[model samples]
Target: MAATVVQLTESKKQIQHTHQVFDTQKQAFRNNPMPSLLERKENLNRLKRALLANKDRLVDAIDRDFTCRSKDESLIAEIMPSIQGINYTLKHLSGWMKPSKRHVSILFQPASNKVSYQPKGVVGVIVPWNYPLYLAVGPLVASLAAGNRTMIKMSEFTPHTSALFKEIIDSIFAEDLVSVITGEADVAADFSERPFDHLLFTGSTSVGKLVMSAAARNLTPVTLELGGKSPAIISPDVPMADAAERIAFGKAFNAGQTCVAPDYVLCPTDRIQAFVDDFRARFTEMYPGLKDNNDYTAIINERQYERLQSYLEDALAKGAELIELNTANENMKDSTRKLPLTLVLNTTPDMKVMQDEIFGPILPVVGYNSLDEAIHYINDRARPLALYFFGYDKDQQQHVVNNTHSGGMCINDSLMHVAQDDLPFGGVGDSGMGHYHGKEGFLTFSHHRAIFAKQKFNSGKLVYAPYGKAVHKLVYKLFIR
Candidate 1:
């Protein structure tokens, strides 16, 4: 094992430049204001065009960064979703922008109440490296739809992808409307210090806390998309092979780097061995030639690879058994940080793999005596970003959904809940804060402005004049239920 080191570099001049950039944008937003409905629609269309036009370049950047991200995955998750989100907002932005009516008291006869939608001005978006483009551009799409100028801070981990995305954004949008800031973690910390109307961050829980504290300095509201040890529960009634295939597809996708990927599996004790056997076979079927498969991704960097290695080593040292899907083949140790697709059996709560998020192709199979035990195990951990259940029984599925709270859940599947435009996507508790995607994304970036209007007639003179018994009686008769 190698020593792990995480370094972030940002200069003072860069920090000053970022502050000035955002300040200028804030001023522009206040003076010129965001475009009207027709103009906003045109802007959205332009953004869609840019994303569609540059799909190949964007996908190539992701592949260079992750080593195995499929073009199809990038198109579906990053390009298409962003375009679809804009279209969804375009179809409904008019209704969403309309002032909501409120009931007025009869005593205040000429007075009326309504709530207007207002932009929060100059929103700051801090994106993670895992889903570099999606995390960066998706939030920007929503912010633009809500009529707010946005500034994005791309993670420094994926330098190539970050630089490419910055170039793409700079070419299409103005600095005042949309700007990209790319550097390192120090830049992120400094960016968080600068006052902004709102901040949205997607990363780890520990980093998410720091971001929250920084936002608290200016009392700026924050929307956090953090990670958790998301769990997958396989019911006894389901077909073992089908469940294993779906789980394998999600767990090994991008080498399990997704924030919402199933970190572990909860299954009945009686079927533990059978489940592992089926899972191993399914993984092989999905990605043949485990050592040299292009579809299988290498770990992000040496740091992450070593961190996962430490977790596996610690778990193995503690007597947990490791079952490799390709046990007969030699380990791909010579490659650039390639971790074998493996599972941990006899896992206990205290094991490091069980305690922390397994952000690699390592799955811990924890057997439970009963369904109650399975639900309790999930509830005991911090609410995860996503929960997956494989069961055909509607009542059983609902039972799991209703009993536990997660950012999202999928029935008989894994990682599919995010595809729905109607459902809100986010986390609860330590997992994450605030929701986004589709309408939820629009609302997250919008500010509802409550307005009260009154006619020239000051009909409330009776109550203002005196607080006597006659006025009190009138107030009671009109206001009391």
Candidate 2:
């Protein structure tokens, strides 16, 4: 009973601290409503330097959190992206910050119009556990570039990484300028309820809904980076080796915990077996063994491990074929939470693996008779965050592009679309909404305030009070048509 009371007291303290930090950031934003371009650039540079200086520590922290996360995977997926995103923002910030000149209609003579992209003060970023460093820093880069004070809520599931990240952030930034909050689910709920000017969440669709609901209380605009079942379609003409290699890398990276990972594959019915064989071969080549392998990553935790296991069990019970890509055939049951890349064949719409976003290294291959059938299958489901189409034929590629709806696409590739700093990253419909990355990231956290200046002439006054004046008639005659 005393321990429960102590836990409750600690929770209260954490909630209080979150509220205090939020208020501090809000006031700080008010004080410096518009940060200068040089200031923004310096902020980005500082972030970049901090990340580089502590790269090894950050990688180690994530490894400890996941138990068996590969150092190279953390470096590639998390640290590299975070640094790249900051550098991208720094390079493009000046152009993005300039007041955009807009057309001044001839009807309104002597008036100049333009749009000023002003920061939306105090942005809230709720980072997910899968790639904590990148997700947190990606949104932070944008928010800082747009001159907004930011507070990040790191995931509790990645406690070591989250704690280390908070320490690093605190060392570099004042609480008023930037802060990182870490706690359990209740603390996250409280953080979401705070009245941030804009909130960006990267997590599951269900949690996104709850975050949106909380933001609604403050009428806070949100950019939700939610996940769904992203699909990779293999064209009938594409070589199985090519398609399988790319798809294998996409699903195998970070053990397929990526939001944009290929959740399933849509392959030609005739080449399904060939694609399967090639994919297995490619994956084994990448990791040769699972247990005690430094290059291979384990599932994040036991809960997630069991969840993926249950998915396999459920799929098997429903008569789906399960192929475990355990090349060395080592018993992983008694080892760490490492799961071999498992493939689910002959999947139906009713299977649990097909229905949910398989965030682990579980790939389900669904056979399609024709390109039209594959396109129709994708169209029937919720629009995914990303769709990968593998084909060399220009007509077939364009056909798929025109018929499909997805946040992003890759032709003859997978997962590389996200690495391109020039492209905007997001989702559509059930997958997610709103975009961030490059200029879109800056815009998402900014409010484009329209400005109109009239120096000498007041043209609008001509039609102001009198109902039937000559000038008013002339104005009406000119514009009414």
Candidate 3:
């Protein structure tokens, strides 16, 4: 399939369509309202059933796009996690939606304070291709639960999967409530220009900036889920084999296409060989048949595949040692767009591979003599979306966690930290900004209105009438700080 490009242009017809969709949905949302807790629970249950029923189709579509999406990986990584999020939201929505009570000061004893949670009218979600199903539904669940209507724009790179997803969602919900828009980049660019109460985008940092700029025209609040070069630090205390296994699984999952996937690993010089050996063994054991393996995903498109190829070639030319966990045999090469699960060693800061986010199955193993060096190396770059530390020591873990800031952290593991529905998922600085999932997701689409209710009272009126000297002292004592 050829890449479809769409350039957004200003036209009366286009603007009218955008406004019509927005206003229609906004009205539906305002009148029908978000479901009651029972309704939400029922809808979630329905969604879970739909996923269960369409699991094979969904997996197949992802495989078609990636060339190798593992069934178990898809179930665990996308389907189950989404179901878990839905269950979490269903279980907690009532409490999350309830009005919060606030304290009234002695001077305002006659008044009561409270906060009401109101939904943001419309939400726009721009999803990425790497993990299309999970990213699309994750934010959709949050937006729906928060009583907001959603318009989801799927990535153009994976058009097949995007079309399939649109079909699935269109079958499930009314277009006015939860609609899917599938087109080229121009459609997305135009969609981003539409007026929305809140916008959540998950993609590259460059695209995130464009989304933000487009959204700014309408003063729409946005949550940018952009990617950065996330680092995984292997501590000396942890067994090299065990650390490698965890890190390898994360980096290899979805062909290391995850936004939070470990882009590079920081390990002590001595343990590099041990880590490499363990990773190789695990990669073979995990997917015994590489070529026809439906478990590993392909790079989303030819451009990305070529981009990764370029990075590998550049790293090799720059004198970085490339070790593949699984080599492309005749069977593998003929049937799949299988990329070698590789580790690059002796990578210097000057190298091109080290300069950007790999976003592929290439893992650069940078050696450091000490933990301080590792920490310093990671801190010097733009803070990532996630910081992964694998160690058992309490103090060392705390030191790393406290001294560095990322969108989130995983101690002794990678990527799994994001599965915790209780934790807020987001990024910091260049990694991205704003948070969602669980209560944070609810709050992300909610407006908290502070309310102060008062009854007719006599004591507060002293300063309002006659301007007396004694009343000034009392008023000053009550309010002046």
Candidate 4:
């Protein structure tokens, strides 16, 4: 009972701290409503230097958090993207900040119109655990570029990385400009309820709904990067080797904990076995052995491990066939939460693996008779965050592109669309809403305020306070048609 009381006391303290930091940021943003271009560039450069200086420490922290996360995977998936995203933003920020001139109609003489992008005050970023560094820094880069004060709420599931990240952020930024808050789920709920000017959340769909609901109380605009069953399709004529290799890399990277990972594959009915064989071969080549292998990453935690295991068990009990890709046949009963890349065949709509976002190294291959059938199958479900189609035919590619609805697409590839610095990243419908990355990221955190300038001329007044004036009739006659 005493321990419970102490825990509650600590929670209260954390909540109070979060509120204090938020208020400080709000006031700071009020003081410096818009940062100069050079100041924004300097902030980006400072973030880049900090990331490069502590790259190894960040990798090690993530590894400790996940127990068996590969160092290369962390470097590739988390650190590299964060640094690269900053570079991309720094290169394009000046152009993005310039006021956009709009055309004035002939009816409005001696008038000039343009749009000025202004920062939306304090922004709240709720980072997910899968790729904590990249998710936190990705939104932070955009928010800072737009001259907004930011407060990030890191995931409790990745405690080590979260704490280390908070330390790093504190070293470089004052709490009023950028702050990192770390705590458990209740703390996250409290943080979400704060009245941030804009909030960006990266997590599951269910949690996203709750975050949106909380933000609604303050009428805070949100950019939710949620996840669903992102699908990959294998064209009938495409070579199985090519499709399987790319899909293998997509699903195997970071143990398929990526939001944009290929959740399932839709292959020609005749090539189901062939695609499975090739996928298994390619995955094994990537990691010859799962046990004692440094390249293959393990599941994040025990709870996630059991969740994936239960998915397999439930699928099997419901008459689904399981093909374990344990090439070395190593015993995995030990403490390492490593799970082999398993393939579930004969998946149905009711199975857990088919129904939920399989955020692990579990790939379910569903066979379709024709290309139309595959497209229809995807259309029937909630639109995914990403859709991958493998085929060289231009007509077939365009056909799929025109018919399908998703946040992003990759023709003849998978997962690479997200790495491109020029493309916008987001989802559609049940998958998610709002776009970020590239120009979209800057616009998402900015309010495009339109400005009209008229000097020595009051043309609008000619039609004012008069029902049937000659100038008003002329104005209507000239433009009404």
Candidate 5:
């Protein structure tokens, strides 16, 4: 934590510098392949200090990058989870790094079995624009704690925040230990193609495929944190007022840019209107002014803004009822990409709003006659990253938890599961492939090598190659049988 942090300038040699940093880190890891516990703790400590020191700076940078990212949202979503991840890793490193003992059979009585957790040389992390700092630092927390070197690739869309990230990282780590690569598509492609020991990607499902392909050439293992159409199911037993507010909070936070944000709601056919009314009321209570409120976050860029607008337009044209949740009733058609929350009802399965992952503050309420039908509706689509069930009945909640399959699920809640360090945060199947939080993250970046050690009394010599007649038959009869 006391090391002098390097001051970095933007590199003009995008691809070349990437290769150079990779080689440099590989050599550094080779020089000290197994960093001591003290060394690893110090690395984590430095990151903690860096995050605490630059808390405000990171908030400002993201606000500039996005038209107006809410300060509280940045603090809660980006900074808070990041600091928690670091703290959780530091708390449990002692036991997690210890070699675990395993059972050995009587035939191997003279020997003992144990699995050692070793570092995976260098790790490559590709950060997406949506949650740049959290994605980068979350993996960094795991990689460094597991005693591996790391290199990060920032998204091109958020150049300002990416550059600021590069600056902050330079202050804490040498490029050889942790380097940040910032450039357009070409640089990102080259960065992913590097032969790192382990690679982790947090982005869309399509780009995850490309990264996995690139990692395949070198036989490098990858952990992809991709996104899908995550859904929320409200049981008929629950009150619409409570269910709607929780769903509204999750959708409105970050303007629904979160990967695990509830994509759509499945309500009892009789209560669909009530759910819509409750959601609108809660949203209005939260943000009284839509256009000028600083607490309300804006979309990241013009392209994303237009994409959301198109979805709204398409839904309206396809006979879907549109209700804009603009509590203030102000005109938000200005240049600022702050979109008011909108609800689309009577949406068909064919509409783009229902087909795509809505990464905006638009919620589509799909009505279902039976709870089984709602679960079936979700299962019919691609597996989602997260699922939520809002109901007071314990048996119904348990049934939902048992029947549905997703990366993670919350009973009567949305978006809180990801914040828990004790629980792993990741996706399943199409949503994502691996996990990275707490011990799971540590294990993902580590290689558990099995070792069997024997004493001077070598009992296994009884079955040596010279004993192919009597001893071999006895061994087969004893152990193999």
Candidate 6:
């Protein structure tokens, strides 16, 4: 009973703090509605400097959070992409800031039309545990580039990294401009309920729904970067070596915790054995050791480790064939929490691994007879965040591009498309909605308001409100079509 009371008290306090911070930012935004281009550039540069300055610290902090997070993976996935995004936004910001001119119709001659991009005040960013630094800063880059005050809610799961980021942000930005909050699920719930101009969430689809529901009270616009069963299809034309090597890289990186990681692979039934052998060989070459190796990252924690174990167990119990790809061939029954990348064959729809998002180093390989069967298999499921195809045929590539539904599609690639500075990264349907990363990101956080200008002479006087008039009828007859 006392614990319950304490929990309630804590929840109330977190709610109060969120409201107080939001109010401060709201008033600050009202004082200076539109930030100048120079000011926005300055902000983006400042953030970039901070991130680069703390690159080592971020790596260390994330290592502590994940226990055995690979330094190279952290640098490649988190720091590099963040710097790239900031640079991309900086290069294109000036042109994006300009007012886009629109042609005025003949009926509205003597008037000019253009769209001015305006910042939405006080954006709320909710960062998930996996890749905390990158996720937080990705939205921050977009929101800051668009000239909006931002408040970030760090995931409670990553306590070490969250605390480090809080310190970094506090030292760099004032409370009115930007701030970070650290708390548990109650705090996240409270943070979402606050009325911000825009809210972006990156996590599971279930939690995204709750976040959207809370934001709906204020009609807050949202950009959801949710995850689902993203698939990598191995076309019949591609060799097993080429296809498996690429798929192995995407799934093995960060132990397959990435939102856009290849969750499963669809292979031709005749070539399943070749695909399995090639994938195992590729993963072994990438990391010669699995347990107690810095090159191979461990699961984030015991809970996640056990959850993955359950998936493996369930797959086995349901008669799915398992091939553990531990190159070292070490005993994995210890408490280190490092899991070998395993491929589960003969996966059925009823199996738990097939039913849930395997955010681990587990790949389910399903056999398909033809391209139509493979396309139907994908379409039958919830829309994914990313779809990868390993083929060089232009006609088949175009067919897959037109027939499939996903947030993004990669041809002859796996996860590199999200790194492109020119492309818009987002999901379509159940995987996620909305995009960020480059111009689309800036536009996502900014409002493109339309403005129409007219001459001093009132042309509308000809159509003033009254009973039917000759000028009104003649004008309508001339222009209504």
Model 5 scores worst on lDDT over the 10 consecutive residues at 1-10
lDDT of residue 260 for candidate 2: 94
How many pairs of residues in model 2 come into backbone collision? 0
Query: What TM-score does candidate 4 reach?
Result: 0.99
Please identify model 3 stretches exceeding 4 Å from their true place. 1-19, 32-35, 327-335, 465-468, 478-481
Give a tens-digit lDDT track for model 1, residues 1-481: 1221222223556677798899889898988675688866777787788888888988888888876666677776777777777778788888877778999867777888997777889999999988898888778878887888999999888888898888878888888888899876788999988788999999999999999999999999999999899999999889999899999989988789889888999988899888988998888887766566767777888899999989889889999999877744856788766687789999877899998888889999999887779999999778899999998988889889889888888888887787676778888889889998877777888888788888788877767744776887868886797
Better of 1 and 6 by TM-score: 6
Residues 1-481, candidate 6: write the lDDT tens digits. Answer: 9998997887788778889999999999999999998999999999999999999999999999998899999999899999999999999999989999999887777789999999999999999988999999999999998999999999888999999999999998999999998878999988999989999999999999999999999899989999999999998888789999999999999999888899999999999999988988888889888887897888898898899999999999999999999767899788377899999999999998898889999999999999889999999999999999998888889889999999988998889998998899998888888999899999999999999999897787778889499988899899878
Q: Which stretches of candidate 4 lie over 4 Å from their true place?
A: 1-3
* lDDT tens digits, residue span 319-338, model 3: 99998766444354555567
Candidate 6 residue 225 Cα shift, in angstroms, is 0.8
C-alpha-based local distance difference test score of model 2: 0.92
Clashing pairs in 6: 407-428
CA lDDT, candidate 3, residue 351: 77
Number of clashes recorded per candidate: 0, 0, 6, 0, 0, 1
**In candidate 4, what are the lDDT values of residues 249-303, reduced to their tens digit?**
9999989999999999999999999998999899889999988987888899989
Off by over 4 Å in 5: 1-12, 466-468
Clashing pairs in 1: none
* Candidate 5 per-residue lDDT over residues 11-95, each given as its tens digit: 3378888988999999999999999888999999999998999999999999899878899999998999999898888889999
lDDT ranking, high to low: 4, 2, 6, 5, 1, 3
Give the alpha-carbon lDDT of every model. 0.84, 0.92, 0.84, 0.93, 0.90, 0.91
